[model samples]
Target chain A: MWDYTDKVKELFLHPKNAGDLENPDAVGEVGSIVCGDALKLSLQVDKESGKITDARFKTFGCASAIASSTALTELIKGKTLDEALKVTNNEIAEYLGGLPREKMHCSVMGQEALEAAVAHYRGEKPPEVEEGTIVCQCYGITDTKLKRVIKENDLHTVDDVTNFTKAGGGCGSCIPDIEKILKDLWDGKVAAESAKPGRKLTNIQKIAMIQEVIETEVRPLLEKDGGDVELVDVDRSKVIVSLRGSCTGCLMADVTLKNIEKKLKEHVSEDIIVEIE
Target chain B: MKIVYLDNNATTRVADEVREAMLPFFSDLYGNPSSMHTFGGQVHRKIEVARAQVAALINADPEEIIFTSCGTESDNSAIMGCLNSMPEKRHVITTRVEHPAVLNFCKTIGKRGYRVTLLPVDKLGRLDLDELDKAVTDDTAVVSIMYANNESGVIFPMGDIVNIVKSRGVLLHTDAVQVAGKIPVDVKKQPVDLVSLSGHKMHAAKGVGALYIKRGTRFSPYIIGGHQESGRRGGTENVASIIGFGKSAELAGNHLSAGNSKLIELRDKLEFGLSETCPEARTNGDTENRLPNTLNISFEYVEGEAILLRLNEFNICASSGSACTSGSLEPSHVLRAMGVPYTAIHGSIRFSLSRYTTDDDINKVLDVMPGIIKELRELSPFVK
Candidate 1:
């Protein structure tokens, strides 16, 4: 019981665009039998117009994996190769009324097969087979692919990276490396834009800016730990807030507050001070 | 749709006689066995009868049986009990294919600075006795192994294991949850220190299990509570389920020899039918040395969850070792430890039968399984 949607079940039972195309323009293969899921995408491309006249997939995986391949084939047909390349893994998941978080790697596999197929058609090296520093030795996932999927899916935690790209799901020896990558990405995003220094913001603008940063950056991390923070008031450089839910009366509240203040300083302003109400 | 359940190793249907034996205790006989009054005191006598019935299934004395909540508690009690009693011994030996109850506990203890040696199995899921002989040391506290694997149905050489571990002057515990009623488990023939048994694996009710601690063994209680189970385990007893377990044991013992022959016939028929129709399918484990009513077959190319779902459409219930079925990213550890190929591991299906399984059930599974595997293989990318 994966809690699969009706659309997923319907597509899995009677998948559209199944099997391989006879003498196709290009064939793309992604994943391997050892990984428990793989897909082979075949395309019929019109040579003059560069439009995909037909697309079919032969997949080896579970219900969600089969449904994802079906959705990918359906999404790519009747479009130019460039337009087909723009379809994200998220859209394949959305076409099936969303997939389980653990099975998101299936959607990622579908997207990878599409890219590999187009790369083959264009006489370029298939990106799926391109070599890089392997982060997950079990699945052969590379650091470059990990960073790309993390950015594309807005993945915040190492668990999310595993769900999307299967980077740290086996043996778990690379989790520290994944943590460092996440930290580097977060730090890079904050350091790239630091409120343009000395742009004096009005009281209302500062409040709204802090609120936006907290919602976008701080809240997601806190919610993962079963806690919440609400902005109460802004007084000059000091910002007041209330810790709610599991955050209240927790022994790690001080550490959490320090982290929050650090995030506020990195994203909002240097003089920003956080105080608990 | 008529349901054909081949997942008996997961759990079995409660027998009619066992259910009838349990119904009285839920209301009319709802009396604490420890009460001082005669009405409640009468219930105590019935529990002792159950203790004798369970003891009779295995060739242990009635006093050796310590009723626990379930098989997991019995396993935990045996391992933690032995470790706590012998604080000086820090090393333990076990196999890689044990049930999670024992494997996970050993892993937790390993993190806590205890030495654990997990013996590896060969491709046929057979233990290397020479490796076991060398692994045992004076510092070893206990050696725990399962009687038969749940997923593969591969039976280890428990008789040889008992001799090897016992000769080392160390305690040995066997998780016999899958073997007690399905096969003969005679404590007299092979005297192990502890044996854990589950009721629901037989035709008994859930929530009731028994652990046999051989007399004069160093032991400590895992759950310390109110004075019960002779202070080895303490809690108010699960009265109804225990009674059902007693009745099921009685029934199992009554027809053990006769029922096994019939089970073997049906299991072989189902295994033969599937293998004949799908020549690419291969049976896993040491088929010659497995349980009579268990068959674990693997089909290449197709994923197991996809095949199982298609089988479900025909109301044919079975179990699989696929990563998708268990919410893990890898197939079963049992299959993995045996070096089963990834091409087949993801498609492994286990069908465990029981005495109640009829010819029609086996026929139903045989008739529909080939079609399901064939359909899934067509959709697989690896299929040529």
Candidate 2:
């Protein structure tokens, strides 16, 4: 059994507003059968009052999706259109207790549908279109939103963007887009840093400085912890490092290496490689 | 909240009498049955008694019983033991819908240069005996068939199958896990070379089962270790669970006739109520040939998981063909092999009754079923 919360189980057992509205003002559909879940939501918005008078939904998915849809309907019913637009996916999940981490997308889908329905009712185009050109094809995320996310979250790699927005993880077709976005952010950061005095250095000089820092600062600390690190070849500003001794088999080796890399990047160049052998 | 358990075909609650019979072996009677001391000798004698108890239920000799870990292990031992005994024989026969325990083993042996023919079943889950006869050849080593399917509860004609295989001088193994306690099975009357039963399927504990190897049948030990099980299956005895199984077998023999009729009546009542209340509902397997306590039905349009969730609200426990495999989106392989239509595949539910299930339990399920099905169907995309 998946350790479902009591609220999730209650909503699954007796889901409120679980049928299609007869005369809905707007119908919002999201997800698909191939994606493992789908939803069909209908809303009855009062034209003069700009308020949602009724909301109903039909979900074809697992417990989390069903519960999220049920809660989403209850959250928006009898609420003004402006208030409905302010509802977030986190709020939806919290309404039905907390959803499992992997199932957080279920609540996110509810928020997406609600936004789409409200957008349709107000005769305004969906905000996702006005956001900008899509940077991640897997999730259809726009470049402007991705840039804002990268700046706000301080993401440095393609994988970082994937962890934040689930952009480059699926099929890896959007990897180049993720890389371009990361490089753009890094270049912008580097330009800002170089504008200050005593921070600018050539690429080759930066690599040498990083290597010296690892051997002096990083290697001594690792050796004290009964481990050793060897520097491998550096290519295209990516340093490869191989761990030895106790670190070779330890579960914490990856974490330790990542922390050292983060430190080296801060002191040296942000684009410098700190390879572990 | 009361938790009702209706998934008896999956497993059963251990009876109190059986548990009491096993307590002594776990505590004061802990001894190695193979040792030469008086303590070991007494424990060995108790094992003999258990063998006799198991044999009496199946109408076989005590010497013919071989203790195994579980039904799947018993199945593997029987199938592999027969193949090892007749190394020259290359062909094996089995059904398409046998449990993965048997089906996967057959597939594994097939990869090792053996000819395996998987026989098909009708829409009602009955095999064509004539097709079985045609599949047999001079190179056939053994024909292993299940006595009753776990999913559909449809009983195969093991007697006729035994006659066919025995006439050909080929060995036959029948997996009687589902039918062992629910129905009467006498190995002396049924012409089979081997039969398998699990204790947990009855009112005994898990981790213990018995395989009946008919006297004079040629076989080899699948598990090679100590001289236990007459050098056939070698391992330390699972003393407590084996004793519990012995007590369960005895109780099963005494109540076999009465339990069958009463269980069938309750199962029929539940089946009729569901079909009458829900529109376009129908049974999945053969009515007359199924286990008395098992009922499989497909409620049109509504998915099984949605129905199960609604039933859970009322604390009415049961299982579904599709709901059990929730993470995976594929329909059941058994239903697909039986050629069940795609429209009805996701909507199937299996309600398996046991001796413990009462009339009130069936009535409670019947009371909540119609409203649950109607509500789910209204939300279903397939419902017209």
Candidate 3:
């Protein structure tokens, strides 16, 4: 009951080119039994044209892993080595319509195997293989690869990184390390946000902006309606204010309240909510 | 496609007799058992009959049977109730391969500052009783073990476990969810303090179960709500499910006394056929000491979920202990605790039979299973 797409089920139940190639141009493998998913991918590259003539794969994994591997093998065949290398894990997952979020690492596994196989075909070192700092011991994911997955997938949380790179998915001992890394990454973003204009503002900047909007846009408009407001406090997204003068117990106080809320949202932040104290 | 179900350990079909017994309670005899009027008095009498019926299956007195919602509730009530009754005892002992109902609860208790000792099992899923003897200390409140494993269907030596735990003056509880109807589970023979059994594991409905609390055992109610179940359990009785459970117990008692020869014969034929055709396939548990109606096998180099999907194509229902099938990154804890090789662990399949299993069901599995293995093995990288 993993909610696998029809395409994923079809590929899993009947995988195309599911076998091991002997005496092939090159071969690659990623994952292991301990990681709960492993794949052995082989390529039959046309040496003269530098094109992949055929591809075969054997995977030991769940439904989505097998389906993703099968789809990757099918997607890369009859294409040039460069074109095949350009196939992303997201593209492979998309080829199968979709996969469950937690099973997205199976698609990442397909990407790793493809990179390793293409590197083997070219007689170069397999790029980004886990010789770097190990971050996730359970899945053998490294810091360098994990960072790239996070950046490319726009992952902001530990759970997001687990889905994209399989880091912290097993034993969960590395979850603190993953959280530290995410905190570091977001810390850098917070600093960059201070410099970037018209981007998401810092917390202090948001507070200042809220106060300025209330002083310039809200107070003048309320004073014109024979009602005045005073800013009381700003609690995260909430802007607390006190009704003074004619605004106190006024019949149209609700209308003024609605006007203040709408103006704050437009000028300062869309999530701002105004409340009369 | 006609289905051949071999996953009776997971859940059984509601028997016709059980269903028949349950129907009147859902409509005409719908009075609450706690009421005082004649309409309700008749329903209360039926509940008393049910208590006797459930107790008769295990040779316990009617007062010893405390009806609960499910196996998990019965287990929780047994372990947590024991801990509550003896708040001074700071230790608990259990085997490494108990169902999550007990295993996870023990883990939570460990987090709550209680010491827990998990005894290991051998490669054939047999316990070393000496380890159990040594692990028990004066602080131990209860040693909860299972009479039979659900994943591998390996039967544990209850007599030895009981003697060892009871000798130390520690309470002995057995999660007999898998062994109750499949084999003889009479409380009259074993002097264990508590035993938990599920109605669904037998042929009754899913919502009802019973716990056997020895007459002199110290206890506390898990749900401390009402004065129902003789102050042992709370809430209104699940009238229809309780009735179905009673009828299923009577039928299960009949099956046990008459001997489940048909079940054993079909199971043996299926096991022999699979073992003869495929040399790589090996059974996981002790062949002689395991349940007569269960067979767990692992075909090396072929993964379990793929094999299950293929078997499902043939309208055959079974279960696997493989990591992929369970959505966990690791395979079954029972298989892992027994030190089963990782190569075969990913491919393990469990086929559990029942009295309803027929020779034709055995024939379909034997005919189609070998080809599925061959097809998957052909695609496997390790097979070559």
Candidate 4:
């Protein structure tokens, strides 16, 4: 049903590096059995040369998933960590001759494991992805990862994002977020990048843009820190604000106030300053 | 490659006799039944004979049988037909495990300010009759339920459903596409208002289906054109398929009466062998009340798509609820509605048999399945 190539079938039937390394130099684990597929990739590298000596995987998934992990191990063998890091999921599917379109996420699982494993090889933690907003909770896909994937792949639809990263593929409660990310990438790519921040604006246009910046960018962070902010009034080059909840009496109130001011100036206009009423 | 097809519930191999009956209609008897000439009139007579045959299968009058394109059309016509007839009723009741034909249709109608109540089923895929009794109110328009589940082959107690619904004076429709031929379905014995059946499921050609509206049921046309099907359905009839369906329905009647020991035996053999040999393999659904031809099994620690692909190596045909198989992220809705555990849901595989299934087919599946399960389990992180 998956339209898997014979090479994929060959790799899946008799995976070359099917078991885990007992004392591997690096390990990468991505996905979960709960999501219906998971992959654990382990690598043994020559410490002096930084070349991968052996690569192995333990996968729980469909044919394409197993094939993807197996293809990943074969692709990275004898390659340096830097060289292996450049191998993408698309390349893994291509090396298998081809995989089904829907199974592209399996290849992504491989790429994620490879990245995590390479980070481990460097004695560094796999970059924790919770820094930004999570756009897809089903697979824990963050806004940062979502934007990077969209721009890299020129993805135009939520379904395209789903195929690449398994985002918006389950529960679908985050589809609005994925769609927002998609909208940002779809239109924001050409507009936001090319549009200069200091473009001339009427008082009304500047006020609307300031409000958009506050609601979209500034509010979420404040909410997470047990505080909330609202714009009481906006005058020419001066924004009046009220900080509610824990922020009203916090020891770091001045820091939080400057943070909001710096954010508004950087994102909206450098001339604008914040004042508490 | 020798294929052992156990996906009959998806579709059936057309019977040899049915094909033979349709040959003449496609070539020499290509006269349009709507024509006035003697050649065309004879074709109309044959269509009548076919209608009678289809009616006889369900014990309905020939006039009451309205032929349509397929089972989905029949289901749409029945449910939509009722709503169109009585615009005041705002609610439609159905089960959570219905085929997408009825479920999706209700969803669209729900968007149009219609309330849809999806009654839940037990872990065994059995609907609670008491819930149905309470859900029907003055606002309820139509209650649509399937005769037998396509995936599990578990039969619903339609008689009890009919009794409860009819007592409330509400209209009832049963989507009998999976049950009409595989089991006995006599509309005359029950007070049901409507029933739908597909030709292809009963070994007839595709592109043909029929709906039986018990005479005197409030009715309207869903197609809304031409006088074909007595103005109930539009467009010219699919002549060859209708005739083939008639011939197939007659054969199915005889086949049903004679019993389905081979189907039951082969189904049991396959179910028993796989569950016994494959460790952690278990069957889903109620084994006793299901159709004789269906056996759904799950191999714990091994996902379904892998098992199916491994089975494909031996040219064995089947289907699974694995997310990878359907390109969706969840298992089968039927299994989920029945509260099947998450551990087993992804690994569920459905092997539906037919009269065409042979002992050799069962043996081939049994021969290859354990190895397939073992091989996938070996690669699985959950297994070892």
Best by lDDT: 1
**Chain A: TM-score in each candidate?**
0.70, 0.63, 0.69, 0.67
lDDT of 2 by residue, B1-384 (tens): 766678888889899999999999989999999999999889899988988988888889999999999999899999989988888999999999898778878876775578999999989888999999999999999999999999899999878988888889899999999988788898878869999999999989999999999999998987789999998999999988998898899988988955577888899999988889989898898888999888889887666766777787788777776522343334566776787765566678888888888988998898989988877766654454
Every model's DockQ: 0.36, 0.09, 0.20, 0.25
Question: Model 4 - which docking category?
Answer: acceptable
- Estimate, for each residue in B281-381, the C-alpha lDDT of model 3 and write its tens digit: 99998887888789999988778888888888899999888777776556788999999987788889999999999989989998888898887777666
For model 2 chain B, the run of ten residues with the poorest summed lDDT:
B322-331
lDDT of 2: 0.80
**Model 1 CA lDDT for position B333:** 92
True contacts kept of each: 0.69, 0.14, 0.43, 0.60
- The Cα error of candidate 3 at residue B214, in Å, is 0.4
- The pairs that clash in candidate 4 are none
lDDT of 1 by residue, B1-384 (tens): 778889999999999999999999988999999888988888888888899999999989999999998898899899989998998899999999999999987876775468999999999898899999999999999999999999999988889999999988999999999988888889889999999999999999989999999999999998889778888998889999998998888888886855689999999998889999985899999987899879999999989999888888888788989877877687899999999999999999999999988999998888888788888888888989
Against the native chain B, each candidate's TM-score is 0.99, 0.97, 0.99, 0.98
Q: Rate the local accuracy (lDDT) of all candidates.
A: 0.89, 0.80, 0.86, 0.86
The number of the candidate with the highest DockQ is 1
Off by over 4 Å in 2: A28-38, A44-54, A60-62, A71-277, B1-3, B88-90, B110-115, B323-327
TM-score of each: 0.87, 0.71, 0.86, 0.85
